[model samples]
Each structure stands twice: as structure tokens, then as C-alpha cells.
Target: MELGYIVSGLFVGFVVGLTGVGGGSLMTPILIFGFGLSPLRAVGTDLLFAALTKIGGVWSHWHHHTIQWHIVGFLALGSIPSTLITLQILKTFQYHDQQLTYVINLILGIALILTALALSLKGWLINTIKANNSSKVVLIIRHLRSNQDFIMISTIVTGWVLGFIVTMSSIGAGALGSVALLYLYPNLYMNQLAATDIAHAVPLTIIAGLGHWHLGSVDTHILFNLLLGSLPGVFLGSRLSISIPDRAIQITLSTLLMLIGIKFIL
Candidate 1:
């Protein structure tokens, strides 16, 4: 077991726990640039790493009664099928082709930028919605609150977009999904919203990881090393979240992600 890989996992898991963002937004890039792994292997290994780490979150959140099963179901309705289709398309691309690597890196870079922006601007966006009672999306959500069918359809559509982005880059299921859900169900407790998003991410990532494994993209050794460190790291970070002010950490993370995004794109 590489101690360095374990350390990488530990740091990423801790950050994810502290911020409630997906590890893929950090982990995949670390593997590629920090650990000198290929982009494909980094993405594949991080997917499984993310799924395993979140299982612990789900279990804890379940005990706390934070997960909203109906919302999770609605998101899964769109995500699972979209994930399958994305994997099939990914498989059609030639393995290890220079063009393929470029495309993956480009997508990964773009996804990272998007996630960073989402994280950095989320509070502002939410506040804007609260301030502008006439905002179109906010008004639509309010109107649809009583219309279960419309709400369900909207949630599924959100999930579909999440599924496609996540399978392609493993970046959106946390930051993007939570923000979208916050818009849809603004009345839910923040803890419940985070828990529901984490719960839904588990299956989405696991299936996506399995699809990558099927295509022989996964590195079991890397996955195992990361899991070894992440499990305990997540536990420790969750404990610390109660005391730490996350805004500072989030700002630091956003800066790092922006730099990384630019690096990958360049």
C-alpha cells in the first residue's frame, strides 16, 4: 500500500466531510497531477472511492433521520438510466487514444470549474432567490410545490443532468445536485438536503464505478489504498465540522479548484 495514496485519500475525505462536496472534485485531479496517474485511472478509482466514503455518510445521516427517501428516489429515477447511457458512450471511444485523453481532460477541467463556481456562488444564489420573490425559478418551484407530478419530473431532470456530468467527470453529484435540490425544495432543513444528496450519490457513483470497472479502467490497488485512509478521515472530519467555520475552508478550496481547473484546461 502506498502511504502517499492513503494520505491523499485522507485529505480529500476530510475536505469532503467538512464541506459536503464530492471527493471527485478534488481526488481525481490529485491522482492525475499529484500522484502521476493517468486521467482515466484517476477518474475510475475516485468514483469507487467516492461511493465507499459516502456510504459512511449515508449510514450516519440515516441514524440522524436526515435522508429524504422520496427525494432520493426522484433523483435516482433520472440519474441511474443516464449513468448507464453515459457509460455505454464512454466505452465506444478508443482506449488510450490521445484524442480521448484530451477530451476527458477537457471535460474534467470544465466540470471542475463548474463545481468551483457552484460552491463559491451557492450562498449568493440562494440569497438571491430569497431576496427576489419574483425570480422565475423560485416562483416556478413555489408553484410546483403543490404539484407532485411536476416536481417529480423536475427532480428527475435535475438527476439526469447530474448523472451525465458525474459519469463523464465525477464532479457534479454533490455541489451541483445539492444546489439544484435547494432550489426545488427550499423548505427542507439544510442537514436533510445535504443528507439526501449524499445518499443519492452513493448508488449513482457505485454504478458509474462498476461501469468503469467493466471497461477495465479501475485500479484496485489505488482504490484499496484510498479507502483505507478515507474511512477514518471522514469520521474525523465529520466530528470537526461542528466546530470549524466552513466558509474559510470553502474559499480556500474554491481558489485551489480554480487554479487546478485552469491548469487542466491549459
Candidate 2:
């Protein structure tokens, strides 16, 4: 069983390296459906897994001067408070395991669906925002673009949503954050967007993970096995990412995630 968990982590980490999505997006689902972990336990375990895995990314991005500190700060301002509140809510329901499981599964399903849509639409959305089309969505984006204050507030609000969803589901801090940042800060380079998203996610996951730990949902032994496998997996996947057709991978991953989302909901 431990070896199975390690293998699962390796597979998930490889995919994450290739796709640059968050580990929680894949890991939590695998823990739930694949390994038969309770939803709350899966979420709790994955949150800490994500926090630990992403620390190196944050350091690398910081060294490369790719991270946007102001943006991270803005996101943290909203996400931190929201995380605390969400943790409190979870604590309140800790005794009701069935209800907690149901809520986590429902939210996880929704988050996965949203992440899938974000992955599918990201390219088209970015193009549409850049094009000189007179579409309503483009017009709204343009309006938001012109209003710096609104954009700043919107970033914070995006963080707030991510905080609540990620605390409950452990699935939104990466893909969803990137999509929102892409929409709000169209001028940002992809690296900058990714770096900023990761920078914010680390702290959010840590706080939430610790809260879940306090609630006794985390499995340290499972987490250790996963990390042991995932580190090398990520390295190998990243090395091979240069050779693969990213569009194909994204499409397949998006489809898989959508199906998983539907399964969770049903």
C-alpha cells in the first residue's frame, strides 16, 4: 500500500511537472478515489504535500526574479483571512465526518470542473483579450484593464475565492489562480504569472494544511512516501517536458479532470 502511494505520487508529480498544474489538483483525487482515503483526509494530506513541493519552486522563481511580490501580497491579504475563516468552519464541522466528507467532495468536484474549463479556455481567452474584437467579454476585460483600482480589488477577490475553495478542496491555488491572473493582468509574462501564483499558493496551502493537521486529518506516513517518489518524478517530467506536445497533454488532462469532476459530483 505504501509503495502504491509512492507510485501514485510519482505519476501525479510527473504530470504536474509536464503541465505546471498544482499537485493537489491530482493528488487529492487520487487519494480519494484511487487510494480510498476519506475526502477530508485526502484534502488535508494533499494541502501539506503541495506546500512542501512548492517551496523549491518559490525559491527558484524568486532567484530568477520572476515572482511579483506586490501581486503575491495582494493575493495573500485576501487568501490568508479567508483561509482562517474556512479553517474555523471546518473545525466546527469536524465531529460530523459524513457531512464534512460530502461538503469536501462537492467542492472538490466543482473546483476540478472549474480548473478543467480554465485549462481548456486559457489560450482562447488570452487571445480574445489581446485581439481587437468588439465582443462583450472583450469589452468587459478592456474596461477592467483600464481601471487599476478595480483590477487590484479584483485580484484580491480572486484570492478570496481561491482561498475558500482551496482550503476546502485543495484544488484551486494553481490553475484557477493562473487563469484569474491572466485575465486581470494580461500584460504579465507567463513566467511572471506562474511565479506569482506559486508564491501566493505556498503560504495559503501551509496555513490550510496546518489547520487540517490540527483537525487530525493529515496522514504523515502517506505524505512521506509520496514525497519520496514525487521529487524524482517531477525532475524527470520537467526534463521531458521540452519534448512533448503540450497542447495534446493539456487536452487529455482537461478531459480526464472533467470526467473525474463529474464522477465526484454524481
Candidate 3:
């Protein structure tokens, strides 16, 4: 069972490296459906897994000077408070395992579906935002680009929403965060956007993960095995990413995630 957990982590880490998606999005679902863990436990365990795994990314990005600290601060300002509120809500239902499981499943299913859609539409969204046209979407994007205050406020609001969803489902801090940042800060480089998203996500996941631990949902043994396999897996996958076309991988992954989401919902 421990070996199985390690293999699962390796596979998930590989996919994450190839697609730049968050580990929680893939790992939590695998823990639930594949390993027969309860949804609450899966989410809690994966949150900690994500926080630990992403520390390396945060360090690398910091050294490269790609991270935007101010953006991370803005996101944290909203997410930290929202995460605390969410944790309190979870605490209220800690003893009602069945009900909490149902809630987590429902939210996780929705989050996965939304994540699939975000991955599928990412290219179109970027193109639409960049295109000089009279389309309503383009117009709104342009307006957002021109307004600094609106952008900042929107980032905070986005973070607030991400906090709640990520705490509940452990699935939105990567794909959704990147997409929202791209929309709000179109002029920023992709690396900078990714760096800022990851920097924000680390602390958010840490807080959420610790809250879940207090709720007694985390499995430290499984987390340790997963990390052992995932580190090397990420390295290998990143090396191979240069050889494979990411679009094809993203499309296939999106379809699979959508189906998984539907399965969970049903």
C-alpha cells in the first residue's frame, strides 16, 4: 500500500510537471477514488503534500527574481482570512464525517470540472484578451488592463474565492490562480505570473493543511512516501516536457479530468 502510494505520487507529479497544474488537483482525486481514502482525508493530506512540494518552486523562483512579492501579498491578504473562516466551518462539521464527505465530494467535483474548463480554454482566453477587437470580452479585458485599482481589488477577490474553494477541495490554487492572474495582469511575463501564483499558494496551502491536520484528517505516512517518489518524478517529467507538445497533453488531461469530475458528481 505504501509502494502504491509512492507510485501514485510519481504519476501525479509527472503530470504536474508536464502541465504546470497543481498537485492537489490530481492528488486528492487519486487518493479518494484510486486509494479508497475518504474525500476529507484526501483533501487534507494533499494540501500538505502540495505545500511541501511547492517549497522548492518558491525557492527557485525567488532566486530567479521572477516572483512578484506585492502580488503574493495581495493574494495572501484575502486568502489567509478566508482560509481561517473556511477552517472554522470545517471544524463545525469535523465530527459529522459523512456529511462532511458529501460536501467535500460535491465541491471537489465542481472544482475539477471548472479546472478542466480552465485548462481547455486557457489558450482561447489568452488570445481573446490580447486581441485588438470590438468583442465584449475583449473590451472588458481592456478596461481591466487600464484600471490599476480594479485589478488590485479583483486580485484580492479572486484570492478570497480561491481560498474557500482550495480549502474545501484542494484543487484551485494552481490552474485557476494562473488563469485569473493572466486575465488581471496580461502584461506580466508568464514566468512571473507562475512564480507569483506559486508563492501565494505555498502559504495558503500551509495554513489550510495545518487546519486540516488539527481536524485529524491528514496522513503523514502517506505524505512521506508520496514525497519520496514525487521529487524524482517531477525532475524526470520536467526533463521530458521539452520533447512533448504541451497542447496535446493539456487537451487529453482536460478531457480526463472532466470525466473524473462527472464521475464524482454522479
Question: Where does candidate 2 stray beyond 4 Å?
Answer: none
Global lDDT for candidate 2? Answer: 0.92
Give the alpha-carbon lDDT of every model: 0.86, 0.92, 0.91
Residue pairs in collision within model 3 = none
- The list of candidate 1 runs beyond 4 A from truth reads 132-149
Best by lDDT: 2
Better of 1 and 3 by lDDT: 3
Model 1 per-residue lDDT tens digits across residues 139-188: 76567767878788999999999898888787888988988888788778
User: For residue 177, what is the lDDT in candidate 1?
Assistant: 91
Q: How does residue 119 of candidate 2 score in lDDT?
A: 94
**Which scores better on lDDT, 2 or 3?**
2
lDDT, candidate 3, 1-266, per-residue tens: 99999998899888888778848878988899889998888999999999998999999999999999988888988999999999999999888988888889999989999999999998998898889889887887797779889988998999999999999999999999999999988888999999999999999999999999999999999999999888888888888999999898998889988988888788
Residue 62 deviation, candidate 3, in Å? 0.5
Candidate 1: the clashing residue pairs are none
Candidate 3 lDDT at 73 equals 86
